[model samples]
Target: MPVALEIVSPEKLLLSRNVEMVVIPASEGEMGVLPNHAPMIVLLRGGTIAIHEGGKVTDRLYVSGGFAEITPERCTVLADEAVPTSELSRAEGERRLSAAEAEYNATDKNDVPSLDAAMDRMQSARAMIEAAAA
Candidate 1:
C-alpha cells in the first residue's frame, strides 16, 4: 500500500500524492516513513524531502522548518517554506547561500536567533543546490 503524502506551506499546498516512501529531515535526524508506519509528529529541519515510488525516487523538495505528522496511512507536512527542487534554479540557490553566509558572518556570535536563521537559510540553499544537481 502507498502512503498519502501532503506537503503544504502557509501560502499553498505544494504536493499531494501517494508515495511508496518518504525521507524527511527531522530535527533529531533523518527519518524514513513507509506505509503502515507508527504515528508520530516530528519537527522538520532545513533539508530535502525525498519521495520514493516503485523503489525509485520520484521527487525531491527543499523544505525549511516545519512539522510533520505521520500515521499509518498518511503523512502531512506543514512547512514554514517549501520549494520544489525542480523549480529552484542553481543561480538562485547560489545567491541565497551567499547572502546567508554574509549575514551570518556579520552577525554577533552571541546572537543565537540570527545565527540559527542564517544557518537555516544556508542549509536550505545548499539542499536545493544539491537536489538540483541530482
Candidate 2:
C-alpha cells in the first residue's frame, strides 16, 4: 500500500504525493513512516529525509527544526526550514559550518543551547552536500 506524504515549507510546498516509505530525522533519531503507520507527533532535528516511492527513491530533503504529524493514512511535516537535497552546495555547506563554529566559539556557556542548535544545522547541511556529491 502506498503512503501519502506532504512536505510543506512556509514559502512553498516541497512535496505532496504518495510514496511507499519515508525515513525522517526525528529529534531522537531516524524515524520511518509507512502506510498505516501509527498516529504520532515528532519533533524533527536538522538532518535528511529520504523518500521512497514507486520502486525507487526519488527525493531527499534537508530539514531543520520542525514537527511531523503522522496518521494512519498520511504524514505531514511542517518545518521551520526545509531545502531539497539538490539545493545544497559543498562550498556553501562548508561556509555555513565555519560560521557556525565561529559563532559557537565566540559565545558564552549560557548560549550553548543556541550554539549547539546552529552546529546541528551546519552539520546537517554538510551531510546533505556530501550525500549529493557521492
Candidate 3:
C-alpha cells in the first residue's frame, strides 16, 4: 500500500500524492516513511525529500527546514521554504550563503537564538547548492 504524502510550504502546497516511499531529512538523520508506519512528529533539517515510486526516486524537493507529521497512512510536511530540486540555483545559493555567513559573523555570540537562526540559514543555503548540483 502507498502512503499519502503532502508537502506544504507557507505560500502553497507543493505536492500531494500517494508515494511508495518517502525519505525525509529529519533532524535525527534521514528517515524513510512507508504505509502503516508508526505515528510521530519530527524536525526536518535542510535537505532533500525524495519520493520513491516504481522502485525508484521519482521526485526530489529541497526544504530549508520544517516539521513533519507522520501517521500510519499519511505524512504531512509543514515546510518553511520548499522548491523542486531542479529549481534550486547554485548562484542564488552561493549568494545566500555569503549573506548568511556575514550575518553569523556579526551576530552576538551570547544571543543564542540569533546565532542559531544565522547558522540555519547558512546550512540551508549550502544544502540548496548541493541539491542543485545533484
Candidate 4:
C-alpha cells in the first residue's frame, strides 16, 4: 500500500500524492515514514521533506515550520510556510536573505521578539537558497 502524502500551507495545498515513502524534518530529527507506519503527530523544523517513489527521490520541498500527522496510510503536513525547491529562484533567495539581514541589523538588540523573527527569516531564506541549489 502506498502512503498518501499531503502538504499544505495557509495559502494553498502544496502537494497531494500517493508516495512510496517520505522523510520529514521532525523536531526530534529526520523521520522516515513508509506504508503501514504507526500513528503519531510531530512538530516540524526548518528543513526539506523528501518524497520517494520506487527507491528514488521524486520531489523535495522546503518547509519553515509545521506539524505533521502520520497514520498507517496517510501523512499530512500543515506548514507555517512552504515552497517547492523547483519554484524557488536563486536571485529571489538572495534578495530575501539580504532584506532579512538588513532588517535584523536595524532592529534593537534589546528587542528579543523582533530579533527572533528576523533570525528565523534569515535562516529560512538561507535554507531555501540551499534547497534550490540542490
Candidate 5:
C-alpha cells in the first residue's frame, strides 16, 4: 500500500504523491513511514528528507526546520525551506560551507544573528552534501 505524502513550503507545494516510504527528520531523530503506520505528529530538525516510491526514488530534499504529520493514510511535511538535492551545486555548497565557517570564526560573542546565519549556511551546505551523496 502506498501512503499519501506531501512536502510543502511557504512558497509552494514541493511534492504531492502516493509513496511506499517517507523518511522524516524528526526532532528527536529519523523516523520512517510506510503504509498503515501509526499516527503521530513530529517536529523536524534540519536535514535531508528522502522519499521512495514504485521502486524508484523521486529525489532528495534538503529541508530546514519543519514539522511532520504521519497517519495511516498520509504523510505531510511542512518545512520552512526545502530545496532539491540536485538543485544544490557541489562547488557552491563547498564554497558556501567554507565561507560560513570563516564567518562563524570571525564573529564576535554578541553577534548572534551573524552566528545564526552562518550556522544556517553551514547546515544548508551539509544537507546538499548528504543529498548529493545519496
Candidate 6:
C-alpha cells in the first residue's frame, strides 16, 4: 500500500500525493517512511526529501528546515521553505552562503540565539548548493 505524503511550506502546499516511500533528512538522521510506519514527529534538517515510487526515486525536494508528522497512513511535512531540487540554483545558493557566512561572522559569539540562527542559514545554504550540484 502507498502512503500519503503531504509537503507544505509557509507560502503554500507544495505537494500532496501517494508514494511508495519517502526519505527525509531528519535531525537525528535520514529516515524512510512507508505505509504502516510507526507514528511520530520528526525534526527535519536542511537537506533533501526523496520520494520513491516504482522501485526508484521519482522526485526530490529541498527543505530548509521543518517538522514532519508521520502516522501509519500519512506523513505531513510543514517546511520553512521547500523547492524542487531541479529548481535549485547553484549561483543563488552561493550568494546565500556568502551572506550567511558574513552574518555568522558578525554575530557575537555570546549571543547564542543569533549565532544559532546564522549557523542554520549557513547550513541550509550549503545544503542547497550540494543539492544543486547533484
> How do the residues 1-134 of candidate 4 rate in per-residue lDDT, one tens digit apiece?
99999999999998999999999989788899999999999988777899999999999998987899999999999999898888878787789899999999999999999998899788777877888899
User: Model-by-model lDDT, in order?
Assistant: 0.90, 0.82, 0.96, 0.91, 0.82, 0.96
Give me the candidate number with maximum TM-score: 3
TM-score of 3: 0.97
lDDT of 1 by residue, 1-134 (tens): 99999999999998999999999999888999999999999999878899999899888888878999999999999999898877778887788889999999999999999999899888877876776676
**In terms of TM-score, which candidate is stronger, 1 or 2?**
1
- Shift of residue 120 alpha carbon in model 1, Å: 1.6
Q: Give per-residue lDDT, candidate 5, residue 62.
A: 81
Candidate 4 has which clashing residue pairs, if any? none
RMSD (CA, Å), each prediction: 1.6, 1.9, 0.8, 2.1, 3.0, 0.9
Ranking by lDDT: 6, 3, 4, 1, 2, 5
Error of 3 at 76 (Å): 0.4
Candidate 5, residue 21: lDDT: 92
Candidate 6 TM-score to native: 0.96
**Using Cα atoms with residue i matched to residue i, what is each candidate's TM-score against the true structure?**
0.88, 0.86, 0.97, 0.82, 0.74, 0.96
Give the alpha carbon lDDT tens digit for every residue of 18-117 in model 5. Answer: 8889887786787889999999889877788888877766667888677988889999999988888777666766776798799889999698998887
What stretches of model 2 exceed 4 Å from their correct place?
none
Residue 8 of model 3, lDDT score: 98
lDDT of 3 by residue, 3-73 (tens): 99999999999899999999999988999999999999999989999999999999999999999999999
Query: Which residue segments of model 5 deviate by more than 4 Å?
Result: 99-121
> By lDDT, is 3 or 5 better?
3
Q: What lDDT tens digits, residue by residue, belong to model 6 across residues 26-120?
A: 98889999999999999999999999999999999999999999999999999999999999999999999999999999999999999999998
How high a TM-score does candidate 1 get?
0.88
TM-score sort, best first: 3, 6, 1, 2, 4, 5
Provide the lDDT at 46 for model 6.
93
- Model 3: colliding residue pairs: none
